[model samples]
Target: MSDQESSTSTSQTEGEVEGELDEEVDTEMEGEGEHDSKHRDSPPLQISSFSSTLRAVIRIKQKYHALKKRRQEAEGDGALTGATGRTSPKIFTFDGTTPIALSVPQKKKRKRRRRVMYPNRGKRRAPPKPARSRAKYCLYLLFAIVFVQVYNAIENLDDHLLRYDLEGLDKTLRREVFGQQGAVEGLLSHLKEYLSTYVHNKPWCCPCTAPAGVGKSHLGRLLAGHFRSVVETLVLQYYVLHHCPQEADALQCARDLSALISEIVERAEEEEKIPLFIFDEAEHMHGEILDVLLQLVSSEQTNEYLNAIYLFLSNLGHSHITKHMLHNSSSTSMAKSGRYSHFVKELTPILRNTLEKLHVLWTEADILPLGLLEKGQVMECFLDEMTREGFYPDHTNIERLAGEIEYYPEVGGHEYSQTGCKQVVAKVNLL
Candidate 1:
C-alpha cells in the first residue's frame, strides 16, 4: 500500500477503537447508575466492579502504543523502498508540521591519480660542440704532399751525385796532388755543385794558369786519369803542342777538334753523363781552334753542349803569377788563406785581360792560378817519390834530395822552390 494511504487507514482504525472504548465506558457507567439505585442495600459489590473497570482501561492504552510503534516502522520501510541496505534516516520536524528525512551520504570511490616521471631534471644542459673546418684538413694534406715531393727531389739529387764518385775524387785529389789545397778546394766545389744535377745552362770552363814545372801538367794528367777511371771513354786529354803543333794545321785542327767535342757532348747527353775535356798547353792553340772551343762552351749553344767540363792548362800568365807569389811571400795574410786563392783573387782579372788580347774564348773561363811551391812542399814531394821507388829514405836523405833542387831569393828564410816538384821524380830515380 502507498505510505500516505496506509497512514490514513491506520489513523481511521485508531479512531474507531477509541469510539468502541467510549461506548463500552458509557454502558458500564449506565449499569453502575442502575446498580447504585439497587445496590444502596449492597455497597461492597459495587466497589469491586469499579476497580475491574480501571484495569480494563489500562490494557487498552498499552495496546494502542504498541500499534503506533509498528505503524512508524512500516512508514520508514515504505520511504526507503527503492534504496535498500541503507541506514534508517533520522526524523527532523519542520515548523511542527511534517518530518524531514536526511539519509547518510555515501563516500565516492576515489580514482587513483597517475604519477608523472620527468627525465634529467634540475641539472643544467651543455651546448652542442662545433665541428672541425674542412680548410684545416686540406692545409695539412697539402703540407704532407709538399714534404714528400721535396724529400723525393733530394733523393734523386743524391742518386745523380753517386755516378760521379765525388768522395773518391776528393780523396784522390787531396792524397796524390799536394801543395795546391786552394786549387783542389775550388775545383771540387764546382764539380760537386755541377754533378749534383744533370740539367745545365752552360759548360764549366776552368783555365789553370801557372809557371812551367809547377805541376800544371801534372794536375791536368791527374784529372784526366780520375775522370777516365770513372767515366771510361768520355774523358778527352787534348794537347795543343802534340795535336796541332803547326800553324798550317790550324784549319784541320779546328775541324777535328770541333767534331771530337760535338761527338763527346752528343754522346754524354744521350747517356745523361758529364764529359771532361782537358786541353794541355792551351796558350799554343790556334785562333781557329780557339774559335771552335769558344762556340762549344758558349751559353748560347744547344742544351747538349752545356754538360761538359773544360780544363785549360796553360803557361800564359806564368810570369805574373810567379811575380805575385814572390812579392806576397813575406806577407802573413796570403799564407793564412792559402796562396792559390790569393793568386786567383788578385790575378784573375789580370789573366783575363791578357787572354782577351789574344782571344775572347778565354775571357769567360774560370781562372784558377797555381802559386809557387814552398820549400817544405818540395821536400814532401821528394819523400813521396822516394817511397814510390821502393826506397825507405830517412828525413836526412829527404832533406838532401830537396836541397838539390833550386830555390829563389836565396837569402830569404821563406824560399820557394824554383822548379816545384818537377825534378823530384828524376832525382829520386837517381837515388
Candidate 2:
C-alpha cells in the first residue's frame, strides 16, 4: 500500500510541476506578446552620437532654409505678377495630414532711405488751395456793385446844386459881400443843402435880419440880381413898401401876391427850375400879405411850393442884431479866424424869436443875422464900389472914405462900421 501511495504522490507531483512549467511558459509568452504590442504602440528609441545629432540638425536646418527660400521666391513672383495685374496661384505644402501656406513668406524689414532736405523746399509754394466757390466770388462782386451804386447815388444827390454853378455863386458872395461873412456863409450853406436835391420836405425859407444901412437891402439886391441873371423869369423881387405899401388894400395885395407866386412856381416847375422869391422890407408887409406869404412858405403847401426858395430881407429884429453885434465886436478875432459860424448860430434864435412875436411865419425861416462890418471890410466895400464905378480905387481915398463911415464904441479905436457897406456906394460916389 505504501509503495502504491508513493507512486501516486510522485505522479501527482510530476503533473503539478508540469502544470507549473506550462503556466510559466504561458506567462513568458504573454509577456513577449505584451512587449511586442508596446513596441508597436510606442516610437522606436534611437541611439546617436553628438556628431550624428549635429549632422541631423544641419540637415533639418538646410531643409527649413530650403522651404523659406521657396516661400520667398513664390512671394516675389506673386508680387511681380500682381504688379502686372495678373492673378497669382497660392503655393501650399503638406506636412503629414496638415497643409501649410508656403507662398506667404515672413515679411522682411524695409530699409528706410535718409531724408534729403533741399534749400528751396520751404520756399516751394504749396499746391494752390482750391479756388473759392464761384458763388462766393459772385457774392463779392455783387457787394462791390451795390457799394458802387450806393456811392454813385450819394454823389448824384448833390448834382442839382452843382449844376446851378453854386461854386461860382459862393465865390461871388465871398468876393462881393463885406463884413457879412457870417451871413453869407450861413445863407450859402443853407442854399447848398436845400438845392442839393430836388425833393424836399418843405420850401427853403431864410430871413435876413439886420438894422438899416447894414447891407440887408444890398444883400437882397445882390441875391435878386444873381437869380435874375441866371433865371430872369423865375426870380421875383417884391418890395413890400413899393409893390404893396401900407396904404394899399391888404386883401388885394395878398391876392396879387398869391397869383404872382402861383404863376411863377407853375412856370418854374414846368421848366424844372427852382424859383427865387425875394421879399424886400418884409417888416412893412401887411397882415393879409404876410398871411399869403406864410401859406406859400408853409410845409402844408402843395409839392410845387417845396421847389421854391423864399428870402425875407427885413429890419424886424434889427435892434437885437445890432445889440448882439456891438457886444460881440471885441471878439472879432473869432471871425477873422473863419469861425464866425457860431456867431450866426448864437444870433439865429434871437432873431427868430423876435420875429416870431409878430408872426409865427418866422419860426420856419432860417435866420441869417448880418453882423457889424469891420473897418477893413468897410474899406474893401469902398474900393469895390470905386472899381464898379469905373474909377481907380486909390487906397488913400478908400481909407478916407472908410474913415467917414461911423463906427461903434465911439471911445475906443474904430473896429466895426455902424452902417456896414450899405452906404459904401453912396460914400464912394460922393468921393
Candidate 3:
C-alpha cells in the first residue's frame, strides 16, 4: 500500500504488542507476589486483561524479531536511511498513547526550502530573433531570378552584335567588290564607335597599312556592310589609273566614279538627303584622277548640295607619304608656284586642306594607337564567350594568346588572334 497507510498500521501493531508485553510483565510479578500471600484484592477484570496480555507476550516478541530482521535487511541495501537515523523503529503502546513518546521524526527544515526558479527567470524581454520569417528563402529566390534575367539580356545583346558584324561584311562586299569580310570586320569595329558618335562632326577616315594578303581590302568590305543604309558608298579606286592597261581603263574608271556619284546625286535630289563617299586605297589616286576627285569634293554640288561624307582608306603610312617621293612629284600641284618649285609633301597639302573643309574622317592609327578591344575588354569578351559554351576560361591561357597577338608581321601593326580560336576550343575542353 501507500507509505502513510503502511506506517499507521505498523505503528498500531507495535503498540498492541508492547501493551501486551507490559501486562505480561506485571502479571508475572503479581503472580509471584500473590502466591506467597500478599496483594490479593486486585480487580478480576484487571486479572483477565493481565492474563490475556501475558498470553499475547510470545506473539509480540515474535513480531518484534520479524520486524527487526526486516528493518536490518532493508538497511543493508541503504533503503532505511530515512530521517529517523535508527536501524529499527521503536515499538509503542496502543489506544492513541505512546508508551514513550518516540518523537515524530522531525522533518529537516531545509533553510525555508528556497525553491529556485531557474528556467522562467530570464525569459521576459529577450528580443525576438528571425524577425522576418522564411526571409532567407525569399532572398535566395529573388537572387536566382535576377541572375537568370541578366544572363538572358547578355545573350541577346551578343547575338545582336554578331549579326551586325555579318551584315557589315555583306555591305563591305557590295561596295568594294573586293576583300574578304573577316579582316574587314576586324578593321571596321575599331572605327564604328567613333564614326557613329562624330557622324556630323568629322569625315570618317581610317588609314591602316597592311601587307597585301593581310586583308585590308576585306576590312573595307566590312565597312561597306556597316554603313549599309546609314551612309551611302561612292567609292573611287583612283589607283586603277596608274595600272590602266588602255585608254578604256581610264574611261571605265571615270564611268565608275560617275555612276557612283550620279546614283548618290539622284538620291539626294529625290530625297533631299546628303551622301557619304568611300575612297578605299585613296593613296592609289594618281595625278589626273586625284585632281578630278579633289574637284568633286571642292564643288558646291558635293559640299553643299550633296552634304557629303568622305572616308579615305589607305595602307600608306602618313609619315612615309610626307617623306616619300611618289606622292610629292605627280600627285598634286601647289597653288602658289615658286622659281625653285620644290616637290613638297603633296598628299598632306592636298588631303589636309580638302579633308578639313569637307570634314572627311581618315581613321588614323596615329589617332587611335590602341584597338577598340582593350586588354580588359578582351579578357571580359573571352571569359563571357567561353562561359557561354559551358567552359571555365583560364586567365593564363587568355594572357598567353593576347601576348601572341601583340605583334604582327608588320613593324607596328598588331593582328587579332581569332586564328587561335582553335586553341581556345582546346583549352575549354581541358576545363
Note the Cα lDDT for every prediction shown: 0.80, 0.74, 0.45
Cα lDDT tens digits for candidate 2, 94-125? 43334434676779999998998665855875
Off by over 4 Å in 1: 1-130, 330-340, 410-413
**Which lDDT value does model 1 have at 333?**
28
- TM value for model 3: 0.30
What value does the lDDT take at residue 348 in candidate 3?
43
- How many Å off is the CA of 254 in candidate 3? 3.0
Tens-place lDDT per residue, model 3, 1-431, is 23664466556655665676567667765775565355356434456666765676676577667765765564455434543323245565465553445558888776776786555665765657867769899999999999999998777656534534545554644344221223333345544433232213323333444323233444445545455544344332333425443554665665567666667756654643345455555556544554455445543443333344455555444334323322233322221223012322234454344334433333121221111222333354456557778765788876765454332232223222222222334544455
Pick by TM-score: 1 or 3, better one:
1
